[model samples]
Target: MSSIEIHQFMCRKDNFGVLVHDREHGTTLSIDAPEEAPILSALQEKGWGLDYILTTHHHGDHVEANEALKARFGAEIIGPGREQDRIPGLDRPVVGDEHLILGEVLVETIDTPGHTIGEISYHMPLAQAVFTADALFSLGCGRLFEGTPQMLWDSLKRLRELPDETMLYCGHEYTATNARCALTIDPDNLLLRERATEVEHLRAAGKPTLPVRLGQEKKTNPFLRADDPDIAKAMGMEGADPVEVFAAMRKRRDSF
Candidate 1:
């Protein structure tokens, strides 16, 4: 079986760094550099050299190490076309539905404009994985930075249409915190309760609780389960549309 190797690094406070290695093609892709030192350190630890830099958006937390990494690695920078000017070190601007090969894996871009106006999530159908930066978290989604509830809602719906078995790698280590908020929106949900317990234990042990499956997210994550009846009632907004419930939940989390 052919599969890409994924290395998730803790780059900055509450931030992430991912390195995808395609052994068959001898190329490596780093997703969203948060800081220079940690990413370089992680690469050195893995003994991997970067070939490409994939930027999901223009957020500083996501792209602060772009310039330095590109300078050091001499790698091409791929960015969302909507905000190429904002995304530093963007060498290649691509739009939604574009297909490109990095090593042996083929990556397809899916525009998910909610956390940022130009946010784009990567879908690797061949590998059955995705690099969802800040758009969809484990138990929640990102704060609506430059888009609307409708925009974010639609963006997640699009991601949901991917293969149910898709492996999700979000941009931050916010699952435990997000899962806490998820309980407020899905108090009696058995899946949420179980997921919370698992996440809590892992975090208590100082372990990572990420790379949640899409199928699991559909069942337990309140942000992804906005249409579920239990989630609606728990949010104190039964009989409401999914978007309405999601918006209210987001508002509550923003204050929490």
Candidate 2:
């Protein structure tokens, strides 16, 4: 088995687009098409051809370039099974827990519905990585646009169960703001304070803060820390259900 190669780049305003390649078989996959120009540029820069498009949801910003890319590369599109009608150029619709083999890698989808109905995150066990799209971020998760906080919480818990070293490739560059908000709620966290400083330095250098390790997020991301005693105490929800703590954190982030 060979390793999976990943290329992460900026697209649109704040969106981050990703490309995954299985070197052994030359199988190239794109997580979402936030835009056409950048994705095309990435492909050109890497001299890699796109073979598949795996979408997380039906948001316009995420799928707007699906048709154009498919037309250009003859790529097969796979996405949320329930939203095939909305996902332009969808060739295969997949629900949660389905597996797709890409060369030496196994791509699995987990249902993540808090950000949007039928949203999913792709986990490649061989690569120890998950393309979370808008469902989960470095130090934050997406808003509750189509589902409740509890739904998002459950979805996040699933991701949290992945190995600590799992790399998280999120959809946007929102870590700076997420870090600030995380500090407000988790002020006593030394790890979070250190991470906030590191995030500031990364953004100051105009670098990407993504592909964050799941273990680091467990320590610094307030949303992921709902079960931690320190976070629960800070939120004044000590002993409360993690779902309730998660809901309160989401509300705070929304207003922050």
Best-fitting candidate, scored by lDDT:
2
Query: Candidate 1: TM-score?
Result: 0.96
**Candidate 1 lDDT by residue in tens digits, 1-256:** 6568888878789887888988777789988889999888888998989999999999999899999989998989999999999998899999889999876779999999989898999988876889898999999899997999989989989888888899899999999889888887777888889999999998999888878889888888778777777778887788999999889988977875
Model 1 misplaced regions, further than 4 Å: none
Question: In candidate 2, what are the lDDT values of residues 1-256, reduced to their tens digit?
Answer: 4378989999999999999988878889999999999999999999999999999999999999999999999999999987889999999999999898855568999998899988989999888899999889988899999999888998998899999989999999999999888988998789889989999999999999988889999888889878887788899988998889999888888886
> Worst ten-residue run, lDDT, model 2?
97-106
lDDT of each: 0.88, 0.90
Model 2 whole-model lDDT (C-alpha atoms): 0.90
The CA lDDT at 7 in model 1 is 87
Steric collisions counted per model: 0, 0
